[model samples]
Target: MKNSKKLFRIMTMCLMIVMMMSVTVFAEGEATEYVPKLYSTAWALVPPVVAITLALITKEVYSSLFVGIAVGGIFYGGGNFERTITHVLNDGLIGVLSDPYNVGILIFLVILGAMVSLMNRAGGSAAFGRWAGQHIKTRVGAQITTIILGCLIFIDDYFNCLTVGSVMRPITDKHNVSRAKLAYLIDSTAAPICIIAPISSWAAAVTGFVPGEDGLSVFVQAIPFNFYALFTILMMLGLVLLKVDYGPMKLHEDNAKKGDIFTTGARPYAYNEDDGKKENTKGHVLDLLIPIFSLIVFCVIGMIYTGGFFSGESIVTAFSNADASVGLALGSFFALVVTILLYVLRKALTFKECMDCIPEGFKSMVPAIMILTFAWALKAMTDSLGAAPFVEGIMKGNAEALMNFLPAVIFLVGCFLAFATGTSWGTFGILIPIVVGVFSNDHQMMIIAISACMAGAVCGDHCSPISDTTIMASAGSQSDHVNHVSTQIPYAATVAVISCITYIIAGFTKSAAISLGFGLIAVLGTLAFIRSREKANGTYIE
Candidate 1:
């Protein structure tokens, strides 16, 4: 409550100043209108910026996202108090909640939460952790195992975040790895891995936006120039292997080794592993592995099913056409049913216990669900204001002007847009079309710029609190959402800055060999530099 009041006052003061500037400009009749004007101006970008800044400062997410939605409402309402309230309620909150696709995602999150709850209650998670501990040995091994598992689940970012976080969290925590660190690992792998994997949902999203062309072909080609995604992977390996920890991450990692997984006082998630369950002693690692394996297989089938694989489409075509949210929700629902039946048959969980987990899982997912709903609504607000078009106009306006440096510029634009909008798919959807126009999808620059777009969008989404993947990462690790966002930024930003430079190099070289080489060296070099400096100063947490 105190944090809410403090954030409210700050936002109100800023809004009042902005409102005054609008009024003075209106009187002159020379400035662009703010009241009903959105979708092609700088103002479309304000809501997320304000919200992200406040959340970072206040360490409160719900209020910060609401503030962002409110800003969007005010702009959409055009200075009418009553209209603002109506817009915020009708078009912002209810609008997103009522949408079928959004509702499907909510269902998936809740169901997955329940499944996880069931696993924990049945002692499957503990069993898996115990099993992992024997093989994993040290903290470094635990972190590397997390990375390896994350990289393997490259089908979908959403699936990756939730699944990896759920599976690896216990193991990582057992090894004294912090929840924040676990979240960063999960978040880093999701989009970064998805974007580079041609078989992933991210690749499909990229291809969907590029009509009348071999979208898949270009997507594959863009992989090498995808400096952000590739270099992010490089950075993660470097961080894990070299024992690199800096900034807020260092504090969390240090605390983790000292037995505090959360450096902060708040724990937003309620899932507990210590609940009394006779199954805990009886459950073996198979209890955990079987259910997880089923979920993945079912989810993949669900995607292809929606994409019409059964109806005649090829695997790649099916993947490209898959409705990920709907498919995932559908798949997870079936998976839940199957998992329940398995537990019941195995006597790992009583039917009543399985029934009990349904509510427990929903309860566990509430924090993530709430944040996701608000984040989606905020994105809806941005859309109402035409944020995508605003970004589109800018890309189109400067495409020719920034020719030689287009990849670098495009990468920066994608990063900022994705960060502001909190959706990589949307970021590239907007810019990709305009990019095709700029290069006519003709030159080598086309692939380079496209790669930059994909890379930067992932980087921004990785850092954004409002990003769905980021939200899932927080939920998966059961870390405080604010903590995950606050700690992930520096790490993601380090890679982003380096990727931007790589794009600049790619834009000119048009040679993956040279640019990619430069990126790898830069990333490894940066890690080496940090490791050396830490060693010299004896500031290394170890």
Candidate 2:
């Protein structure tokens, strides 16, 4: 640990010196409107690569992400100290924070955090856990119920992550399911489910990206060919039923069975040790249920309202044009108000106690909020460096030659881009248009390729540590962020591999049924094989 810290410090100092020297050399000239020398080149991807690699290697996220941002600043400013500092702060951090959408998300997170705190303090969470324990008698039952809830809340991935995590965390804890596993379940169902759900924000984002076509019709047609999203769900069920886990996740699970839900010492958002002792006796299941249900209903209504539902747009059109950040912020605010009123009316807590939760809730979410800000700043750096164009050039340059193999190729590209930038919607924006243009005449192939793009984006988002959904999952489950990322990767990777192969099959066969059928069998077959190996090793859970 000391060695790693020293190395990190040394690396940071060296980068600073390089920037200072560059400043001395370039200080003589008057600054002009600056464009990065590395814009739209392969080098644009270096910052995220640096950040992600360091994060995985160091098991420390904040410093790693800062280094990545600094690298981006260096690249953007050509090593000039003043330019690098200004760009990193002005364009990277402040720029992203200044955006209304990002602010809305931050607000939503804080409000949701407050709501979760309220639920905990009022004893709604404990009451629900007690209620669920009566009906869900096993670890398996607890996990399956979590999955079912995750799948049901598919309006938006962000909403799904926090809502599922807040609701299911208590139940999972009661049954000895690891926080890492709960996070994985919450994350796996989030984007994967949202990408395939037609009424979701993801579906809206994808549809808006396509031009000169009926976007919704195209999205609906592409659904069956979305191998990654479809197969992720299948894989989750197979793992749950087969009672098998492998790689880092298995260790976490084994530890959980032994009463250590967190295999590592790091527990970033753990509740207070005395929290259970403080539970109010007046709290009931209704306290939790009513708040969650209202959140869902209001969020849906809030989303459509932003899309102009009140102004006469149809529900489908409203959803397809909704602003998730704004809608979620609005909905969550109302939900928080309603929750406060409910608590006060029921005498679950005094109004002052409810008021105190506001700050407590914000404190709980601080870690997640900080990570998101850095992630967004990193993305901003990538954007300024023109990562999108770099990717666009690659897709356009290679599209025709890879014809029948294009969907598979597109999937891989989507994965790499989204993984690097940690933004699935951005990946969709860059790759979908290229696919549309390339396969425009062949409507069937266009649909398949688009599905591949969406699938790959979600797959990458699922695995990337810097991804907001992934970060949210960690926060929701109160697991160490790095631990969540490390454990979830193997499971996501397995599904990704199968999805890649399925996309290849879809390209040649042009039949969703055939390709999807093959993918399902492959998933089950692989899980069965894994179960056999675990049994042979005497490590099978069941």
Candidate 3:
């Protein structure tokens, strides 16, 4: 397709998503206390439906998000009247920005943008690609690389999806690996890793949405109960060892083996296509490694500082109390400064050239910033309508009946919501109120429930055709969307099953370590069995 058509479609989609989100936000804020229960639930979830509709129609992420935001705003604006426009501005836009949680996410994203820019300018991404390319020779190796990289970059899912996808795409492609497979790998690892990782931005975002609990401390406690994440990671590891080909995933592998390749979406920066294009133009590989190392080192130190690590506080306590945005921003700034120095010293370009990369880096993040802003608007709208109270009431009641199966049930529900809405954060936000209210007294059960919520959302979002991570993963791998979704479901489900079992055991034992350890053993045993069977058949995909 022509660039103009693509751009037009993209803009149209964004407008739709924006409109839906705006309606939702505005409607909730202006909703009357006497509003009907059914109407309120419809109002609360309208953005997601609109988002999916736009995505399916436009086949674009930004467009879908924009439309979702707009629908949310319209709902909040009350029947899409002109008079409600003022409310959207005052209540939706202002409210979203003023939110402490939203503000933190914005700051974190902006800084992440800067850091990514520095990484690109410093050649860190390319360096990582070069390093990964040398070792990942087989399909199993590719899957493992994607999983490990996803786990390593637990600071944020957005960062993980984009960066890992960018770095690994070339290697995966070279091995005749399907773009769909690569997308699966990226999506699978993205949220699952963040949901489990204590210091990540997902934790920060989820913590912010939770009420009546110290956002940070609650997250720390919640980590132990996050059985979905623990199990998902194990599943990834199991897939690597066993190489089990099942369901749609098996067909995808078969297609890939036959060299069937398909790709869609806008060609954003043309960054993923050719690895060697800038190799000689860029400085030595260390130019990349140094900036990345510095970025990681400083980010950790920064998180520590915000948490007041040396002030005689516990590590978990410090993390919970830390100013995450400031920490992430400062760390990114530090990396940027270091990147410039490296560029100058290496004579890769003049000072002017070095300075030019900053804006260029930020330019790449415009899409992310826009989508995030719209998402925030949707959140504000839903909250204003008292969506949380209703959801909490329902989930809490349901939990009473299924407390014994809370882990598995929450996992399933989380996945369903995320798949339908195309957002793990939204799923997490909606579920938190329910989980918190239901398991407030039972700390053990609460942990299990919350973990399942986070994990289940990630798992479903990882493979869902509509999910942004799924889209980005496909875009990064330049793969077909249906192909990716079809192939990944089985592997994800396998993990889901094991993860559910682990959560049940954890609830009884109230021990995270034992549950995780025993769960890993079970996953490995499952993998070994699959491997032995595959060897016997000699036709994994078939």
Candidate 4:
């Protein structure tokens, strides 16, 4: 079965190459602006299609994405093969290594690793395990708790995803609640909440990318149009109440029932590692709390520092000059130093054990880093080749003619870009620039367009199995990424179908109150039904 899957991936990759080549020859004239205009829209669409087709058929995200990236690079950089290769090295690989944006992400991941390790090594994980083992007695309670945590952490998607997974995994595992379920809970909460929240990194990112006359006004105007984001949060609430596990997620539930489990953290959990000096039990709740609180506080301080609270510069100027990577690194280091001292003072583990734990924790993040690098590479190559411009031209130029169906069309387009690139941020970045450009000029259309961009990017990420949220969900759950993708796809599709309808109605009405009113009611009503059905079937009962 594995061999066949591998073969299928190879064949699909070959097909993508052929399609790209054909497009290069046929539409060579149009791409003169960028890379000789090798592939027309018709041709450009082939890579994502092929990538998705292969991922669905072969169930290999990494291979599928790499193939898509290669196709894009080859198509865009074909004339300058050596230069293209160099570009991938300099721009794709080293760019990720050197750029402030990419480096900041890496530092954040490392800090997250350190924090998780500190918690686990200090016996904070075990304490939670013991506490949850005693308190979270029922399946329904477990799922609900997972959802609640997801909702509570609305400050940022990265914070939400990593912290929720790290803290909850042990508790979820203790209750025999599948990791896949935990992953879904985390994944659903992260982007969905970030989109809806007035203050979040996602919102800030949008603000940064959008060229605007009034930052506050533009943001306020955009609230109504962010349909998918609002709808997805509704869907998450619905899923929590209903316990509807369909698609790949359903399989994960079944696997959990059969006791299929994988752990992807510290070596101490593996049971095979015999280096056991009896694990630390002195690590109290405060050991975890201190580091976590410190991390958060330091991050805020870092933000302030960057924003010029200390520097005497204007906040905007300071922020513009700040490097997120440096902030994350410094914050993490501070947290790590403080947390290590706590452990030493508490005797949670010896100094050596603490030291060993840090390296292991960082090592655990390797897969995530690799996935991010390749994902970014694919995004850079496509963006350089005018992918966003092409999509924007098509969508904006046709918005007036296709007024009623604009929501569904935009939603689908956002989904396509997210799925292809596996990064909602990237998809959001591309769409916002274009959508803001189109909508900022007109009041009526701006609300709808901006909202569509938000909804579309989020919807795409929610569905795309290749997306980082999906990957983190799978990784955190210890489920196969493909399995998680397959399971979550159906549920995502259902919500999207409903969301599209919501978008269409909202567009024509152009009344935030009306759109939100009817939309929330419809989503809640659907969730109630699903919950009732699940309870009746004994799938979930409170």
The TM-score values for the models, in the order shown, are: 0.94, 0.98, 0.74, 0.85
lDDT of each: 0.86, 0.91, 0.65, 0.67
User: What is the C-alpha lDDT profile of model 3 across 276-379, one tens digit per residue?
Assistant: 44344354667766766776777767776887888987876666666756676667668767877877777765688666655655565555555556555555
lDDT of 1 by residue, 1-542 (tens): 58766767877788766555444332224466444665568998899998898888878899889989889877876765666667789988899899988898899899998888888878888888888978999999998999999999999998999999989987898889999999999998899999999887888899999866799999998888888888888888899989998889999998999999998988987445444353466687877888899889989999999899999999999999999988899889898998899899998889998999899888888998999999998998898888887778777777888987988888888889889889999998898888877887466888888888898899889989999999999999999999999889998989888888888887777899998888888889999999999999998876
Q: Write the per-residue lDDT of candidate 4 for residues 1-542, one digit (tens) a residue.
A: 68868787568667566644444332234444545365435455555665666677776667777676666666666544544555557766677677777777777887677667767767777677677778888666777787788888765666677777877776676666666567667788888887776555566566666675554456667776676677766776666555666555665565665665432222222431222234457656676678878877776567547556586876544544444456556666787888888888877877998888777677767667776676677666666666666776776677667765665677778887787656776776766666666555567766676677677787778777656666666555545566556666776677777777777887688777787787788777877776677778876533
Q: Per model, how many backbone clashes are there?
A: 2, 0, 46, 12
Model 1 ranges with Cα > 4 A deviation: 1-35, 270-279
Worst 10 residues of 2 by lDDT: 24-33
RMSD from true fold, candidate 2: 1.4
lDDT order of candidates, best first?
2, 1, 4, 3
TM for candidate 3 is: 0.74
Q: List, residue by residue over 117-172, the lDDT tens digit for candidate 2.
A: 89889999999988997999998899899999999999999999999999998889
Query: For every candidate structure, what is the RMSD over all alpha carbons to the true structure, in angstroms?
Result: 3.6, 1.4, 6.1, 4.6
Which regions in candidate 2 have their CA more than 4 angstroms from the true location?
1-6, 25-32, 271-274
Q: Score residue 497 of candidate 2 by CA lDDT.
A: 94
lDDT of candidate model 4 versus the reference: 0.67
